[model samples]
Target chain A: MNHLFFQINPLEGFFFGSGKAMVVAGVAIIILIGLGLWLFRMESRLQRLNDALDQRLNDAQNQPS
Target chain B: MIQRSWKIGGLALLGYVLCMIFFVPLGPGLLEFTSTGSAGHVQDQDRKVTVYALTGFGTHWTESPDQLTVVLRHGTQLASLPLIETLDATHVLVGMDLPYTVPSKSWDVLVTHPVDGTLLLENGVFLQDRFIDEQTKWANPEIAEYPAELPFHFPYQPQILETIRNLMLHVPMWFTMFLLMGISFVASIRQLSTAHDLHQDTKAEASVQIGLLFGALGLVTGSLWARYTWGAWWVDDPQLNGALVTVLVYAGYLVLRATIQNIRLRARLSSVYNLFAFVILIILLMVLPRFSESLHPGKGGNPGFNSYDLDSSLRAVFYPAVLGWMMLGTWMYHVRLKASSIERKLRQLQ
Candidate 1:
């Protein structure tokens, strides 16, 4: 267990060897992913809201008023 | 026209900051030193010791070998060592004659060059005392005067090294988060004043959402920085814990908003809760950290990067990065607010 804990995987080794510049890359990637997820959630919410609005409009048109 | 300019300006400024962060080179710094015969430790009996040094970027040691000089400093006393050889641009050998009795056991190394300025390695060499003599006289050499005009470069910190570039990224995230949270706080106040205006409530909610996102990014970047610098991903630090708690508290505000069924009651309750959360944010992030012991810089009586670490070169990019990030975060909050308004309109139609 101790040996395993001390052993650095290839990915970790690459980051460590590169003067931890990859850590900065990792941070930038995380921010990009976060922003992307937020945008996607907004898109889906808008889609759902548009569908609801369309359904209401169709129901109003069908009714004899 | 004015509104469009800010967005364009923000993008431009961030692009400039990104370019500068990557392109700017670090100043000269001493990495490590070694003695040819005895390993860095000198005894009073030893007459001469030749010390070899390895330096990080911008040294240019071989260019003007005549101007380069090495000195050992113990408190106020200084002794200039002879530069024996300049091996390369980044390596040099200096010879030091051991004094019979010195003022101190620990000695600081200062390598000075006109072009590179002065690079210091604190407690670089240690002396093993054969006898402690109180009346021994020490030579005091004058410190080198740096030229008025020096090349523009980031300050090379021994520990931080290249990862210092993260300053532009990590620090700006918190600044952006703070600006968004401030917007949320103001909107919440307006929400309470204006007789359950759902628009104001939506504004508060949207800003909090964006603020939380920026706060999470700050935590992640800070954790990575801490992992490299402090040798731990997470430490029991006051400033760090305070920031984490502030993020969690804002998260609690979102959870509270979801639980309430009636729209009017929800707005009222959440607005009041937002006020409390904002207060908690200020206390946890700004006030408490200052009073307690913390590993994070600028907290717990620790002199912040502003005092010595943040040189003029760093400030050139850092201020613009903060402003750019805040503008981007505000733009995101506006987008979130617009979507929320459209959603509200659709729900009202139903």
Candidate 2:
């Protein structure tokens, strides 16, 4: 059609209409990234807990039972 | 042994989901098309109407213009129009020689391709004339049937289109969330019966934490999907509101656990709250939505995964996606449970 320009209107080009697939993919990626951060935090917490447990065990042994 | 089984099962199902989701090609079908003039309207005089076609695949119409024919069909009646000339991979221009007036009603397009073997696009073309009901006399009562042995793929719904692919990601998140919350509910019941056992409390907490993660993912994905399809990020639909409320209730459960000073009291109180929240979660997500009107399909007397929306082709990948996500959530819960147990042992050493 004569009047049909490229339908890119602002950010709608990236998120709306046929661009919906990209939006969904972005959401999936964000979820994975969030989970990755959660895992990293959990690992750090576990490491600290393990270190505390080891220190307590060592302290009890040094105190002669 | 149980931990090893969990790891193996979770990994296997996740792999299955990844393989099936990416490897399966989208089915070939007409997505949409619009002419320079309004759809379904016949011009009073002769004019050049440029047809723009949006097909899933370009291979169907890559052939020379002579090989493909665009025909208008109404009931048993059929009229073949001339292709005005320009032919691209997915578009065509048809010069209409309207000898007689075609009344206003929805018309179908039959694209006869040498390779595609008479591919049909229902409601493909519309011819709107002033005389509305007069066109029914020329209507074709015969329905066009698709080839039975087509490859496995999701159906192309008008509003959803390519976003139908999100069905695998978004819907499965909610399903998995519900599953994890269900596990948490069971664990809470066990904790109460066992007089707030530490292990059961840890398991319940882990399940709820992972379940909340999945629930949050579902909400974000659903919101984005609604933005494109329903023209808004959030709507006042019962199913959506119910999900938001359920997640908030679970958040309160976490807050309650954190505030209580005594371990046993925290376990007992949180377990009771979790039981209440799970009941509300079920009522909000499942029961209440069904009883009220909602835009979400399969809810409020809407036809859901019936013979229509979720066709056999979709069910192939959908079932595995649901299973894979549920298993993955369980794996996350197991990891959290392991961490909690390690913390408890550390406390004992202290």
Candidate 3:
């Protein structure tokens, strides 16, 4: 097989490599996780409020008066 | 039961997204392939000759330096060269002897790590003089054949490197945002046509609200990616500005909904405004950014320029990421819709 011909240059760029790239990923993941948890808690709270409302409505219907 | 199914599908998608994103292997390839000198220093058979080769970080190099092998390929001819030493995770010293004339000028350096497999550094090193006269071009016999069943991995990119994985998270957020907003646009159209169904308006509101959340995520992640890669948290790029404007337009829709006193008036006005905003959103986010000069790829001269191009191995993970996030966004929109309905019922009781 013919050897592929392409230019290979030496790596150069100071401190602009994998470490900083990972940091960007880390911060983004943190934000997504935090926001997801917040949304989960909010949904749970809303569910509880809706259940309470339903219970109150049921009790009022059962009153003799 | 239908609602329950939606939740199940959404949860399943979320699980799949997490597994694919985290578990894929990087595969055996060159993390970094570079030579210390432009042309390998001239070799004198009588004296010790050494040149440096640097590998990228995260290269699997657990084996001792002796276990590593470096081969030089000139056309079809192959020569196994000795490494003087391993400097660190990134550097190696290669010693070459010109016993035979190198067949071609385009010589390649092949580094075989004990476990990392073979990385071919092509066209970087050269011989000082021509020794061999015959043209002996053939495949290098020394290159190691890797196992066929290597686990799936994100493709290694020259500039992005590890951050290439970020494509799964950052790019998908925009896809999810676009899908959710598209749904919202349809719901607003329904609100206008129907006899002002409160349910449709609520659904539209909920979709935009969740879509905004995803848009916010896209912007933040994109900004972070730019900060590391482009060396800035924010740039005057059209795509970035377009995304911001789309999010703000949706936000304005929410504010408009909040301020109105009359229910019919609010629903009517908001739906009309939503239709206009959705059009502007499409124009700004989709159409305008493609034509302008932007650092983002797939724009102005960079046709599929970035690693996110259609043929990328990232598509395996990225398509699923988009589907999963869109599913999650839909699930959130549904939850918000139900919550709003419940609130309305409770208000009636008051």
Candidate 4:
């Protein structure tokens, strides 16, 4: 077998496996989630502002004028 | 109200479950194999390959002139495997493909020093998808005409398997998004004919939101698929290009509404524009496929859902997935509409 001068190379198995795809999907998930959270916080802040304005308007209207 | 809420909630729950279902058994082989030429099976005649020596694995020579390196691996551990060919000073040449009928569910192979019986190489696997393969015998001077392309190899790629998961997550999102957009398109038509401002607004807002969602999901899912299948995040496939352009057009619809102050004109224009969009959507997605080519299935490539694309295991989840996602999208539209109108009133008050 030594005199024959043989060569054996292994096969390359997988290229562009799903790992990279998952990473992209993960990023998209994070982005969507962050946007959702920001929308929620914005809604809360707007509600607070609306409430304060209503309170101020009520006070002015109730003033003895 | 409670009943409606329950219905919507139920629908949403179903959609979430559907999206989350990669758990269902996707056919037999947990480690699926696909090959070049003959798929997973090896052919006769072209047998024998040269590769880096596995110092101590069992080597099997097939009658078909194919070389096979059988690594009897069990789970994650690499144990000792029988090696028929003796490893000389020149390094061992194990065949690239071998037939193994595993009666059990596990096995391993390892390299050890025969003298001290010490294990030298325990287990370290590095198998990349190489461009030039054993079939390139013709390219070499000595064996340029060697007709042996043994062991048509496919990998137990987790990503490809995970891509099978896309049958659940990715497809449903687009389906749901499209459903939402279609609803918005219909509403826009009614609003246009009736001149009901509320209906018009609903149509406009819903279309924009759902269209945006579809665009975003399509972009994200597609990028993920490309990363795995095509080895790129984006490609210039005609179908994808059309989809992307359509998405941008819808986005422009939003921007168009925002910039214009004339309420009536914006409403009217956007409605008409949406109708045009629906037309373009059909043309780009369905009609043009007769003339163009696309890698995506529905567009042009292997166009129908058959055994190759949608197997029975896939159908079990896939059909339900569409229904679930559509219901969820409708619920999202309603909830989002309530929120949108409330915000609008608030803005007017301010």
Task: Give the winner by TM-score.
Answer: 1
The TM-score-based order of candidates, best leading, equals 1, 2, 3, 4
Task: Encode model 4's per-residue lDDT on B104-203: one tens digit a residue.
Answer: 3322333223221222232233333324233222111111112222232121222253356565557667666667667768877876887646556655
lDDT of the candidates, in the order given: 0.76, 0.69, 0.68, 0.50
Candidate 1: residue B192 Cα off by (Å): 1.4
DockQ of every candidate structure? 0.11, 0.18, 0.12, 0.06
How many residue pairs clash in model 2?
Answer: 10
- DockQ of predicted candidate 3: 0.12
Once fitted onto the true fold, the runs of candidate 2 whose alpha carbons sit more than 4 angstroms away are: A1-65, B1-6, B19-23, B31-59, B64-86, B95-104, B108-128, B134-136, B139-144, B148-152, B302-307
lDDT of 2 by residue, B1-350 (tens): 77456555655565555555544555445545455553322235355443444342323566555766666776667766666544455556665443356654677777666545465678886665324554444533333443523456555455665467678879889989888988989988899999835889889999999999999999998998898679899999988999899999999999999999899998889999999998998788878877887788786554234446777778877887788778778767876887887877777675
In terms of lDDT, the best-performing candidate is 1
Cα DockQ of the candidate 4 complex: 0.06
Cα TM-score of candidate 3: 0.67
Q: What is the lDDT, from 0 to 100, of the residue B103 in candidate 1?
A: 72
TM-scores, each model vs. reference = 0.82, 0.73, 0.67, 0.54
Q: In model 1 chain B, where is the ten-residue run with the lowest total lDDT?
A: B38-47
lDDT of 2 at B322: 84
Candidate 4: where is the Cα deviation over 4 Å? A1-65, B1-22, B25-159, B298-308, B346-350
